[model samples]
Target: MMMVIVSYDVKTSDPDGAKRLRHIAKICQNYGVRVQNSVFECLVDTANLELLKEKLLDQIDETKDSLYFFNIGKKYHHKIEKFGSKDVIDLDGPIIF
Candidate 1:
């Protein structure tokens, strides 16, 4: 598995723009854990990563938005650390709503 960091900047000033931004966030949520409003940390295989990139590209308007993917390799665990109020979430855990 590879650790992929996905970030995006989308410009919007109208209702359509708001919808677009929500769509982008939804797409990222399908593939990773959101670490920030516009950042996600994804753990996926190479093929899935490629697919994710394609899907992201298809949704973004290049003329007004930007997307970035950083493949930090499989050894990313060794380099990761956290501090402050943020706590890691276990995605596999049961959810109560």
Candidate 2:
């Protein structure tokens, strides 16, 4: 799977910027992604990477700019997953509300 690391520095750090980002993120959900700290780590087929790029571009206007995609997998290969007590789920079946 191709992992896409996208970073963008917005001209407007207002809600507009965040809104656009969230919109794009919604589209990216079609593939597979984990958005953290303004970086979208997308796991997808190598062939679909371009498709993901296109979707991101569609969300952005001609105004934003450092918008870069760093293809990682060869560079860094390790990342940790953290959990919290309140976020834990039972291994059995249904979850209590």
Candidate 3:
């Protein structure tokens, strides 16, 4: 599996825009862990990654919303560093609840 970071900015000024934003966020949750309100960190194989991208693309409006996928590869652990009070989420560990 490869580590991927998905971030998005959806225009939510109207009701339709808000619904789309929520739908996009829901889709991200199925494929990865949500680290922020509009960002997710996912570890998936290439095939699944492609599928995730397709799903996200279909939900977003190209003219009004933006999505970004950062392919951090398999060495994400070493490449990522954190500061401040955010607890690092263990994506590969068992969920306790």
Highest-TM-score candidate: 3
RMSD of candidates 1 onward, in order: 2.3, 6.0, 1.0
TM-score of each: 0.86, 0.57, 0.94
Candidate 2 residues lying further than 4 Å off, grouped into runs, are 11-18, 74-97
Tell me the RMSD of model 1 versus the true structure. 2.3
Least well predicted 10-residue stretch by lDDT in candidate 3? 80-89
Steric clash pairs (candidate 1): none
Regions of candidate 3 where Cα sits further than 4 Å from its true position? none
Per-residue lDDT for 47 in model 1? 94
Give the 10-residue window scoring lowest on summed lDDT in candidate 2: 84-93
lDDT per residue (tens digit) for residues 1-97 in model 3: 8899999999999898999999999999999888888999998999999999999999999999999999999888899787877677888888786
Tell me model 2's lDDT, rounded to 2 decimals.
0.61
Model 1, 22-93: lDDT tens digits are 988998998889988899988889999999999888888898889999899888876767677877764445
Query: Please, what are the lDDT tens digits per residue for candidate 2 over residues 3-87?
Result: 5677655545788877886776676566554455455666666678888788778778657643678776533345424355433
Instruction: Arrange candidates, best TM-score first.
Output: 3, 1, 2
- Which pairs of residues have clashing backbones in candidate 3? none
TM-score of 3: 0.94
